[model samples]
Target: MDIDRYLGPGHRTAALVTSHGLAVADAAVRLAEAERIHEEKEELAGTLTRRWGTPCHLGLQTVRLRTGTEEIPEPWAGLSLRVGDVYLWQVAEQGRWVALGVADLDPDDEIQLLLVVTDTDPP
Candidate 1:
């Protein structure tokens, strides 16, 4: 249902934006979480969706892996990925792999994406 009457679609430009995990460039993590929510939303929502007429698209997650005594690898082991002034640490290890949505895709390499800034934390 296109709500063009009540809310018209418009064009806008953004110099920067980091919401709903839009700053994350980890394709695997983003996909995993996106899929996880897709499968679990209905189950988790219970009667919330039915009553509200909208599915709650949840985001962000953290979990611990039973690695025992094994050593972690680079990128994943460091616990964070930094882009510009943003530092995105914490992943499947620290039980915090969030999907920063898709900030911007590379024109040359479509697969490459520029995730959100994570250097500073919210006060």
Candidate 2:
């Protein structure tokens, strides 16, 4: 499952197409619409959790790393991440990590789920 099909090129992320056949929505919710967006994200997260198993239970974790930094690893090394309030999950079987978060993608703050293929855990 190539993530490029959903997220475009230049993203060194993996795909979360588990044996359960997980699929992500191509469209993102606008972050500016506070309350409504929150509900939408929660609803989406709930759906994902049910199908993808439980997420990494971290009280408060943020992935703060630049695109070209040593702190980042392969599959995520080329990706610029500035995520807070993230929902993380480790797909041990596939040796991959998935994180669902909101990104400030210039024109809009969009909700995105990134699947990173890594042996190590999230930093």
Candidate 3:
């Protein structure tokens, strides 16, 4: 998904779509002013959010998507993909938005496994 051109520039300039779909879906509870409904929504959102995925799974590809840096794996050798802090973004396609969860290098400095979430935006 991070490599999907459908997200950046030609599309909506939003490459990494963060998965806040669950919370977004439960937003109604916030407006409804129902404590029970709100709690349920929160629980549901948390579960779905974790189940979806994280943006960090993109790894080096994320660097390219975020900073236009492709992974080369060359330490101090010209560059090898601009390395930096990880980031998350909300992506949209056909009015459907997704959330790219947090990212970080695993203990091995590799792409950390994560869950990404998706949700439809209200018109």
Q: Model 1 residue 86 lDDT?
A: 20
- lDDT per residue (tens digit) for residues 1-123 in model 2: 445643433224533322111122223323333335445556767887997887874322233334434465433433334234556677677776665643333233333443443455655
Global CA lDDT computed for model 2: 0.46
Residue pair clashes in candidate 2: none
Best by TM-score: 2
Please give, for residues 1-123, the per-residue lDDT of candidate 3 as tens digits. Answer: 344322322222222322323343445532343334334434544664575433221234443453444432212111113222322334434333333322222222322112222242211
lDDT of 1 by residue, 52-122 (tens): 34432322221113123445332221222221112233233434322222212222222112222222221
lDDT of 1: 0.28
lDDT for each of the candidates? 0.28, 0.46, 0.31
The candidate 2 region of ten consecutive residues with least summed lDDT is 17-26
Each candidate's root-mean-square deviation in Å? 18.0, 8.4, 15.1
